[model samples]
Target: MLPSIIIVNYKSSRLILDCLHSIYRQGQEEFEVIVVDNSDDEEGRKAISGSYPVVKWIRMEYNAGFARANNAGIRAATGDIILLLNPDTLVEDNAIAECAARLRSSEYVAAGVQLLNTDRSPQITGNYFMTGGLNHLMALPAVGRLIRWLGYRLKVKKTNVASAEGLVEVDWINGAFLMVKRTAIDKAGLLDEDFFLYAEEIEWCSRLRRIGKLCVYGDLHTLHLQGESANDAFGSSGKGYYNLSDRKGYQIMLSGLVRIRKQFGAGWFIFHLAAYLFTVPVYLLVTIIRTLFLQPGRKREWANWWGFSVNVLRICGFVPVILSKKPHFYKVL
Candidate 1:
């Protein structure tokens, strides 16, 4: 086989079906499809598996989060090349083939495809590793906007994928459409299961970097219905739910803490604590101003404020009873 594509479906049966449809439309049979149903949706699984008999469906006992679920698929996959694709994605013709080709041709351990939103707008498909300085700047509202504006103007921005050509090296590619060589997996080891959802790929990329380079292929693109599962879980509580998904926000923060603690150690955790403390007042002020002014996206601003507050508490060793009792937010039903 050319490669084994693994997709973890979390209660997004309809989306996964659409994804599989796209794959079949591509008419590439040199690979296999493995679907890990973390949601354990029996009806959805049966329907999809019956319709797409070739798809390998693994019914999970419960939600195991992104990392472990992917690891399960990775273990079951027999291909020398492993692809971790999101269920909420539509693959373009030859996109996976091109990525697999790039991985085989180059010394790179992993390769990812350009991903776009439904409107065909380019998404942030890849990113540089988060540094303390960059994280601090992004945490401050004023500086963050300025930094983003500068990045947009610089033309070297990560999201400027529409004009990007060929395969470019990157610190890490988003897990939505990541492809990795089997040798790289053997060398770098499986993804850290500590990260339930968000930041898992970033941590895994760090390990891959130790073994080989990671690149983002710009020749092909995939349509990604971003956050479909997360939105279904924690959305529509109020106005402009599209601006922010609380489920994703919480999982990102929790997984981010896990990533920082593991990757950078206690020193960086203290650094993050100091940085969060320094920016809390500014974030609070921004939240109040945005709310009182009835900003167009006040909901998202408030969501960011809430996320920062929760993360600060976590940093201070004060875990809420609910979260303390349940460590992985992504697995919560």
Candidate 2:
């Protein structure tokens, strides 16, 4: 069965063109490409469509976010396998076809390949479920280190799991290069529209995990220019390690809260929310102290932590909407 690759475009027209070039260069002619243009860039559509007339373009009236746009593409897909690819990524060699073949032959319901940075270094592709207050605890400096050490001592697989066949069983794979059977998606349902950006894939994987295994082909690789598309949609300052101060970071933290609420229910969600709220002062004090004496140039770091803390509190305002099943756009940008 051929795979239908769905790429959600958000003002990254040039990047999407390069991504398409990489895919077509693979010479794998059995697959179909669907470009869900959230920006509705007529010029980009004309440029891309003019080059690849076979591409199925679905133009959105507004920036519909990742989940909604991909859902639109998925609804239009006719292929047996569906690949949710990022517009900023370039598939290496036969990574797409090989990933599809692996999913078709194995018991895995969904699969992701090894993601690489532009330098070809491996990026984090798969990870275990972030539940049970683990997400909240991991944000704390000391507790996070202790938890990691304990996890290491217990051999708790946090990221990718190694197998003899070069496939790793993971809780969820990055959405940038995820390939899943159309039947599995039919069972698990489409991407939840409530999530405007981040953490939607993890929530979707939570449901997909209930049905079958999810794996990653460790050998297959794809170059993912991480956050390039987001940087295009919402301008970035290009500072900080995670840049949690920016609008993008705010959306990420907020959507993560939503994902916790949706996947684990209200109790765990409340626990995490309280944990985050409680740690706000601690993060603030530490950053303030570090910025004053230890690292003067770390003002940006302090701002990032402060912004993240403020956004966490802001999430409190949206708790009612987060808990409800009602559809809402959680766009921070």
Candidate 3:
């Protein structure tokens, strides 16, 4: 069966075009490409459609975010295999075909390719489900080393699938290059629309795991230009991981709480929420100390952390709204 590649595009027209170019370069692959344009960029649509006349384009009435837009594309896909690919990524050297073939031959329901950074270094493409305790522990400085040591001692499964020797079973695969059989999607249902952005894939993967296995192929590589869309929306952080602007960080934390509540239970949700609340004062203390003696220029870091804490607390008021069955967009910005 041919694969249907679904790419959800926001305002990244140029990036999407580049992604399409990479896909077209893969020789003799009978696949359909669906572009769900959330921003309704007519100019981009014209440019892309002019070059690739076979490309299917779906324009949303408004900015529908990732999960909803991708759901729309999935519904319109004609192929049995569906790939949710990021617009900022470039598939390398038969990666898409190989990944699709791997999924077709294996018993796994869903699979992700190894993601590479812009410099071709391996990016973490798979991860274990986040626990409340691990989330809290990772917040503190120099805690990653301790977690790695403990993880080694405990023989806990590794989180990065790219480093594995072969097809590795994982808790969840990153949405950037996820390929799944249409049957699996039909059984599991579409991604939850409540999540406007981050953590939606994790929540979806949790549900997908209920039916069959999820794995990542270490040899299949895709270069992900991570955070370009995010940098456009929120000012550039100039660093990888853990350095997000106030609004972006707030959205992530808020969505994470929602995911925890839906997947684990209210107990895990409350634990993480309370952990965020508890850290407010701790961050405030650090902010004051840095302002007093340390590099004042670095004060933005603490302020961003404080802003995230404050916004998380603010979400408490909307708990009732979020819990209801009615549709509500969870965007903070």
Candidate 4:
């Protein structure tokens, strides 16, 4: 078999079924759709089977976040290449064909794809190279505001980057509409299950970079429904863990990839931890005041700050899996 389409479905059973049906109806190639539903109730599975029996559905009794679910789908996949798509994305007719052609034509590429928004414009999926340093440096609170302004406002998009028109090696690709070579996954290992929500792709892409450059073909395009994976509006509430996600993610990266003992020289990463100890509380106060006053709700900023602080307290002796260097990672359209 060629590359199989692997998608993890959560509560949006309606959207999930719609996404799969679109592939079945419009996918212009030979492929199978594997839906790994993290919904414990089997709600998504039962719904898909009743309507779209042709699609294969895998049910996990608990919500396994993003990385673990993809790992499950990859393990069950029979295709040489695997397309990890989000349940809220829409596949264009040539999406699969374009991805296949790009990967098949180039031996250097491991996996990637073009992503678009509902308006049919390219979506920004970040860079092929994933990093905490770049995210931290560019998105460094005050100065990062400017970088985010440009990146989120004006930057390269998924459609323009992942086309077949030319071939360029990239650092990281977005997991939203990512296409991966099965061999690449074999080489890189499964998505790091530690990332309960985000940064798993960056971690995987980091491994892929070790193998070869990741290819992004702009010709193939898919529509990504942004809010599907996150809350309706990030506002102030979401900014914190979403913020801490990177911090914690970086710490995980550091510990997993580069031993803290190596980078900080035997318990040196602790200085940063001691600093975070104070900052985490301060961050909660600021985040809560900002979000609660400005854009309130179930915002998780304080929660994330608290969570990240706990990790900083724990990663006292482990190495970080990710480096703090900033590279020109790609942007999704």
Candidate No. with top lDDT? 2
Which regions of candidate 4 deviate over 4 angstroms? 27-29, 126-132, 146-166, 232-333
Candidate 1 per-residue lDDT over residues 290-315, each given as its tens digit: 78875755686776677666655654
In candidate 3, how many clashes are counted?
0
Over the stretch 179-232, how does candidate 3's per-residue lDDT look in tens digits? 988999999999999888888898899889998999988877899998777666
C-alpha lDDT of candidate 1 relative to the true structure: 0.73
Candidate 2 on 72-109: residue-level lDDT in tens? Answer: 99999999999999998988888998888878988999
lDDT of 4 by residue, 12-61 (tens): 78888778777777635478778887766476678788887767887877
At residue 110, give the lDDT of candidate 4: 62
By summed lDDT, the worst window of 10 consecutive residues in model 2 runs over 156-165
> On a 0 to 1 TM-score scale, where does candidate 1 land against the true structure?
0.83
Report the Cα lDDT for residue 157, model 3. Answer: 59
RMSD of 3: 2.6
Better of 1 and 4 by TM-score: 1
Best by TM-score: 2
lDDT of each: 0.73, 0.81, 0.78, 0.60
TM-score of each model, in listed order: 0.83, 0.91, 0.90, 0.68
> Ten consecutive residues with minimal summed lDDT in candidate 3?
135-144
Residue 144, candidate 1: C-alpha displacement in angstroms: 3.6
